[model samples]
Target chain A: MTNQKLYHAHIEACVEAMNACNLSYVANLKEYNLEKLCECIRITRECAEICSFTAQSLSQGSQFAGEIAELCAKVCEACIAECAKHNNQHSRECIEACRHCVEMCKDLMVAA
Target chain B: MTNQKLYHAHIEACVEAMNACNLSYVANLKEYNLEKLCECIRITRECAEICSFTAQSLSQGSQFAGEIAELCAKVCEACIAECAKHNNQHSRECIEACRHCVEMCKDLMVAA
Candidate 1:
C-alpha cells in the first residue's frame, strides 16, 4: 500500500499497477483456458490486496503497522518478480507500485 | 483474504466482493467529482487490498498469520459498518466479503 497524501500520485499509480496485474492475470488465464499460471494469478491478487490494505491500515494508524509493513515487503518482492516478466505499461506500473511499497515497508519496519 | 483451496467458492466470492467495492468507490466519486467520500473510498480500497493480501499470506503460511488475521478483523469491522450505509448490490457483496473475512480472521486468531 501507499500514502497518497504523502507520496503523491501513488494512489493512482498503485491502483493502476494493481489493476494491470489483476486484469492481465485473469484475461490471460481465460484466453489460454488453462490453469497453468493460476498460482501466479492468485499471488498477484494477494499482492494487490495486501498493498491496498497496508496503506489503509497505516492511514488509520492500526497497531500492527510494523508487522503489516514487513509482510508487505515480502509480498511486494514476490509481486515485483512476477510482474517484471511482462513487458507492458501495466506491468511497468505494477513494478513501480511494488517498488514503492517495498521501500515504504522497509522504512516502516525500521521506524517500528 | 480467502482460501479457495479450503473455502471452495471463497475465491470468486471474495473477488466479487472486493471488485464491487473498488469499482463503485472509484466510479461514484469520479462521476460526482466530489472528494467528500474520498476517505470512504480510500478505506474501501484498503479493505479490499488487505483481505486479498491476508488470504495469500495465510495460504503461504506466513509467520505473522495470527497478527495479520487480527488486523484483518479490525479492518473488516470498519468496512462492514461503512459499507452497510450503502444500500446496493455492491455494498451487499462487500458486506458478505467483510463478513467472511471477519469470521476467517477470528478463527485464525483463535487457532494462532
Candidate 2:
C-alpha cells in the first residue's frame, strides 16, 4: 500500500482505539466516580489525545511525526499497563485499542 | 505557580482551545461537507485529541511531558493556520484557542 493508504489504515485503527478508551473512561468516571483511579484515567485520557493528533500528524507527513510516534508508544505503554488493572469490559477494549496503537506507533516511528 | 498549579492552568487553557476547535469542526463537518477541508478537519481532530491527552499527562507528571508538549505545539501551529482561513465564528474561536495552546506547548517543552 502507498504511504498514504498505510497511514490511513494505521491511524484509523489507533483513532478507533483512542475513541473507545475515551468513551469508556468517561462512562466509568460517571458510574463509579473512583477518585482513586484518577491517575489511571489521566494516563488513558492523555494517551487517547496523543493518538488522535498523531494520526493527523502521520497523514500530513509532519516532520515531527516520527518523534511524536515514539513518544506516543511510551504513553500507550503506560496506558495499557494502567488499563490492565481494571477488569471491566471497557478497560479490556481500551487495552486492545492501546495495543493496536502501540504497534502502529512503533511502525510509524520506523518509517519516519 | 507550583508545577501542579501551572500544569492545571496551561493544560486547561490548551484543552479549552482544543475542545472548542473540536466542537466547531464537528458542527462545520455537518453543515458543509467540504472534501478539500478534509486536511484541515483532520488536523483539528488530532490537535483536539492531543490537547486532551496532554492535559492529563501534564497533571500526572509524565516523564515525556516535555516531548509531547513540543509535539502539541507543532500540531497547534498547523491547526491555527488552517483555522485562520475561515471567517466563521467557530473557526475564529478555534484559531484563538490554538494560539493559546501553542504558547503553553512552548512553555511546557522548555520546562520539561
Candidate 3:
C-alpha cells in the first residue's frame, strides 16, 4: 500500500480503539468501579490523541515519523495491557483495538 | 492534587495538544509540505491517544498504572521533540502541552 493509505488505515484503527475505550468507560460508569473506569477513560483519551498525531505525522513523513511510530507502539501496548484486566465487553474491545494499532504502528516504524 | 484531578488535567492538556497539531496541519495544507504535515498528524494523534489512556489509568491506579505512566512519559517526550522542529505556533503549543503532560505523568508514576 502507499504510505498515505497505510498511514490513514493506521490512524483510523487508532481512533476506533480510542472511541471504543472512551465509550466503554462512559457507559459503564454506573458500575462504580472508579479505578477501572478512570483508567479506561485516561488510556482511551491518550490513545486517541497519540493516534491522531501519528496519523498526521505519517501523512508527511516528518523527520520524527520513525521515532513517533516507535513510541506509539509502546504506548498502545501499555494501554492494551491495562484494558485487558477488566472483564467487560468494552475493555475487551478496547484491548483488541489497541493491539491492532500496536501492530500497525510497529509495521510503520519498521518501514520508516 | 487528587489523583483524579491530576489525571483530568493531564488528559485535557493532551487533548489540547492534539487539537492544536490537527488544526495546524489543516490550516497549513496549502503549504503542501506533505512530509511534515503527515508526521505532525501522526505524532499528534499518537500523543493524544496515549495521553488519554494514561489519564484514565492514573485516575484509577490500575495494576498497569506505573507501567503506563512510564510509557506515557516516553511518548510525550517523543511528540514534544517532533513538534519542536517546526517553527509554527501550533507545533510550539503542542510541544508545550506534551511537555506539561510528560511532567504530570512522571509525577503520577512516582506517586504510583
Docking class of 2: incorrect
TM-score of predicted structure 1 = 0.44
| lDDT (0 to 1) per candidate | 0.61, 0.76, 0.65
Give the native contact fraction of candidate 2. 0.00
CA deviation > 4 Å runs, candidate 2: B1-112
Better of 2 and 3 by TM-score: 2
TM-score of each: 0.44, 0.50, 0.48
- Model 2, span B1-112: residue lDDT tens: 2366668778787779778878765655554335445456557777887887788888877888888888888888888888787778888888888888888888887787
Q: What is the docking quality class of candidate 3? A: incorrect
Put down candidate 1 lDDT per residue, A1-112, tens digits, no spaces. 2222342233323333454445545444554634555666776778767766665455434557678879878987888887676566655666776787677677777867
TM-score of chain B of each: 0.74, 0.88, 0.76
lDDT tens digits by residue: candidate 3, A33-81: 6865677667766765676567556654366777887887777787787
Candidate 3: where are CA atoms >4 Å away?
Answer: A1-3, A28-30, B1-112
DockQ numbers for every candidate?
0.04, 0.03, 0.05
**B54: Cα error in model 2, Å:** 17
User: Which one wins by lDDT: 1 or 2?
Assistant: 2
- The candidate 1 chain B region of ten consecutive residues with least summed lDDT is B1-10
Per-residue lDDT tens digits for candidate 2, residues A12-84, read 8678878977876565555443544555655766787788778877777677877888988898898889888
